[model samples]
Target: MHVKFLIIGAGPTGLGAAWRLAGHGENDFLVLERHAHVGGLAASFTDRAGFTWDVGGHVVFSHYGLFDRLLDELLGEAVLRHQRESWIRVAGTFVPYPFQNNIRRLPPELAWECVEGLLAAGRDAAAGVHPDAPAHFRAWIDRVFGPGIARLFMVPYNFKVWAHPAEAMSHRWIGERVSVVDAGRVIKNIIFGADDVAWGPNNTFSFPLRGGTGEIFRRLAARFADRIRLGAAVVSIDPAAKTVCTASGETITYGRLLSTGPLDRLVADQLVGAPPALIEAAGRLKHNGAFIHGLGFDGAPPDSRCWMYFPESDCPFYRVTNFHNYSPFNTPDPDGMRPRLRALMTETSFSGYKPEDPATLLDRTVAGLAATTLTAPDDAGRLVSTWEMAVDYAYPIPCLERDAALGLIQPALEAMGIFSRGRFGGWKYEVGNMDHSLMQGVEWADRMVAGSRETVYTL
Candidate 1:
């Protein structure tokens, strides 16, 4: 198929580009998705026992109006509005999220430690205390939250979630990604035991009422169904020829290309003639994989919590989503008489830095859930279905050298008629949320057709 525009990977980014192109009366484009479905890393699945599971725990929260309007249009009345009630399990206690702000939930000694550190940090700041510029994530944490919060929560929590030490990562990508503590409000909440509901961008988000997160992208893809070639994986790309060869051995050419796959995969694995330095830089781009373990219960959950974090070392999972709570349809027997019929999706990070033994991962996850009190003791036998999914590129680790690598790779691809944008495409975890991913594609389309400046991906 020859077209004016060729898109690789039919995820949010590719869909955004295609949707935007269609808005411009430009239909001479084709989106090639390797999988039989859209949504990319944002896809969802149903287990044999009838529990719906997303790629990871995805919630709808947009920084762009375009994304908001599109979500409203696609999901319509099938949206499940939710108030985000998230928690952190530390010192064997469930504390409200933004662990620093809710340090009072910790034991009195620990709480006193946090408060003392906060007061000391404040005093230091007042005394014109100056420290060296924070060049890494660990230092940034210490600089912002002081040693107390960092030692108690930030350092340990981040290590568990990222599966990489904070000292090895860069701090530049942390723009509203990690909620910084408000010392005054934290003290107030701590003194009064106030449970603050609103915290992050996803404090109030929504999901599909029925089909998990994938339903949104499925409906969005139906808009230009004819132009989408499902299960068409790009095996090779010749930038000079402006053509892509699929795994099925079909040769399709395009005038322009927008890729939503991993930048490393495109350059090192697919694209021919990528610069040597670009290839090396791509190799240097560190990212961790994810093992999404879903468990379906015949009974309800321990609590009505939306999601919770496990920062301690005992738990294999960093975060566990009350999948059933997201939508009743996520449970097979939602209307069934069982008191605790629900689903819990746990995310475990795996990479070279944190190699996970998959054979016992599910076992570990179940134990972790019980240990963290996400499920009841008897819920083990009640597990009707256990589903495990692996994502090779779950998060783009913002190492100290990440931007330098992106600088070398993206411009080279752009000059060669390739615009790589999305969560993994751009690889900027700060702007790598669902909304940001779609907007990256939308802005890319706008940039291509109207010469508008792209913001999220910053091309």
Candidate 2:
């Protein structure tokens, strides 16, 4: 089979590119997806008990007008807007999200420590005596947040979430993700106990009212489904020859190729006879896997909070989301024959340094809920549904070596007429959100058609 434009991985990135192609009245393109459904890591499903769970915690906030308009068209009135109510659990207390901003919620003494550190940090910044750039995430935390807040929450909480010590991570990729502390606002909020929320674009987000996060992608894929080949996993690719072999033992050649899977896998494993240094660089690419554990319970009223972070060692899971609070449609209805149930979703990370056994993860996640005061004794006893899923490429870890490795591999692939684009394709967590990933696809399609520059996934 020969396609004018051949694509791999029918997730958001591929679908986004395909949609752009369709918008331009180009229908000769075909998208090859390994899975039967779309959405990649953003996918969602309803369990046997009729409870919907996302791949993990997924909320939609846009940084682009095209993506916003696409959602408006696909979801229309069914889109549900939400106010962000995120929190963090540490020192046996639930502090507001971005823990540094709400130090007053901590115990008086610890809160004092955080305040003192913030003041000291402010003093340092005023003096203009800090590193031009932090050596790593750990140094960045200590420098930006000061030692008090870093030790109390930033260090430990980030450790759990990333499943790697802060020192192992690079500070280059946290462009807009990390919230910097504002001493004046922090002091004001602390003095009067005022909630200083609404920090980022996600302060107010939107979701589908009916389906889980997947519904958005599913609806988008519907527009270009005729060009999508589901369950067509590409086993190998001959980049030099511009051909891909699917699992069905069929060979498909393409004029231009855009792959949305892991860049490391494409170069090292899939692309036959790639450069040795590129393969070695691909090996250096690091990622943390995810284990999602969900619990549904029979309850009258669920916790109204959106999501909470864990910085302590009390819980194996780094972050927990009150999934039911995101949407009532996430759980089953409470008719006379059935009891309405609320849901809790937790995610644990695993890497060589912080390995997690899938067998014990479910139990550990349940115990973690109780350990962190998320569940009461009564609520713990009455269980309704439990489900767990794993994604191999949860986070593309931005290490000291990540960009250097990408600097080597991406250029080589593009030279061979391949455009690797998407979350893992670009491997830039800073630009790896739903909006960024989709735009990467859209821009890649535009670049292919009009010789435009690809900004988001630039080599």
lDDT of each: 0.87, 0.87
Summarize candidate 2's per-residue lDDT along 256-368 as a digit string, tens digits: 99999998989887998888999999999899998998898886354778999987887899889988878878888623245557789999988888899898888777788
lDDT of 2: 0.87
lDDT of 1 by residue, 1-459 (tens): 699999998998999899999999999999999998898988999989989999988998888887889988998898989888988888888888878778888899998888887777778767767566677999888767888788878888788778788998999888777777667977899778797657778889989998999998899899999999999999999999988999999999899899999988999999977778888999988889999998988765456789888878888998999898898899887675667677889999988778999999889889988888777788898888999998888998999888989988898888898989999889899888888898889988898899999778873
- Model 1 steric clash pairs: 299-340, 299-341, 300-340, 300-341
Residue 450 lDDT, candidate 2, scale 0-100: 85
